[model samples]
Target: MDGGVLEDEVNRARLVHAAGLVAPDDAQLAGALSASDDAIAEAGRQRRILAATLGNAVNVLNPSMIVLGGFLGSLRDVDRDAFDDEVRARALAASAENLELASAALGADRLLIGAADAAMQRLLADPLG
Candidate 1:
């Protein structure tokens, strides 16, 4: 839920159903990314949200790359181009110029890797360990 585009699919389906354009709990919702205009629009909106959030971070942190992990890593399947464009537009021009947006190479193992990293840091800090 904390991941940006990761939690958007459910909301997209809900909005589509609420508009009466689709049936709730229907199979069509599974394919909404490809078949529904509303779903695509929702994805765009979510991507914009992600872009804005990242842009703000870029302004403060100036990170050279932003790796989208978890569900957001799958954004390439939904709207990678739009998301990239939005980030470029919203971020500071200098920060955005050489910025790289990439999917987490660890895939589902990102959390595991993070935990391992924390454990390593703790072990290194504890002299008696």
Candidate 2:
């Protein structure tokens, strides 16, 4: 999903967590799904913002697929239809016509390894690292 999880909208939940709005570890967007109404609402808000921001990428990159992983998949799994509808609505007609989103096979709890994998990609690309 590119920068979807890194955007301000998604990060807002973390900000709330820091401000003591949600419970501990709520920034991860997975654990508190049913633990608190505030967390659930925050997840909904993040999903909407991710859709809007992710659509920006679709227009520029025209990617055929988006692979959701970690807590990102948690948000998608919460409401698939609504997530798809929002993304399709925000994305440009032509860009979204062939768009598809898939969950990463390793599932939603692999954030650490996933991040390490991403970090390794940079070194792989450079080769001089």
Candidate 3:
């Protein structure tokens, strides 16, 4: 609907609490993914929520692959197996069977690179554009 609840669950404030970070951005996530006990527990909880959300999407769309970029890739990288297990548990068997979760090949710069590629393609197609 309005994304109010999802936004509440997946924002910097809770992440800050989870990771015990002062910066309240990437540090929040990094801290959660750290090797500390608090990190393990918090990271696991976050991953479960993320996986359940993905599983709900899979049930609706049955997509073959889900590509994550930016911080999302880092989130998945923290505990891929655990995330996969959570998704499998929540997703329909048929939908989860062929699903693949992957990270962007271009890392964090993929959007800029894609924009440049699009511009080049357009320029080559019409040199005056």
Q: What is the lDDT of residue 52 in candidate 1?
A: 78
Best by TM-score: 3
What is candidate 3's lDDT per residue for 1-129, written digit by digit as tens? Answer: 245565555544555565666664443465466756776666566666778788999999999999866556666778677767778789999999989988667864677899999999999999986
TM-scores for candidates 1 onward, in order: 0.59, 0.65, 0.74
lDDT of 2 by residue, 73-121 (tens): 6777778788987888888999999999866777634677779999999
For candidate 1, lDDT tens digit of each residue in 29-86?
4345456676666655656666777788888888898887644555434667767777
| Whole-model lDDT per candidate | 0.65, 0.72, 0.72
- Report backbone clashes per prediction: 0, 0, 0
C-alpha-based local distance difference test score of model 2: 0.72
The C-alpha local distance difference test score for the whole of candidate 3 amounts to: 0.72
What C-alpha lDDT, on a 0 to 100 scale, does residue 14 get in candidate 1? Answer: 48
Better of 1 and 2 by lDDT: 2
Q: After superposition, how far is residue 33 of candidate 2 from its true place, in Å?
A: 1.4
The weakest ten consecutive residues by lDDT in model 2 span: 18-27
Over 4 Å off in model 3, which ranges? 1-4, 12-32, 35-38
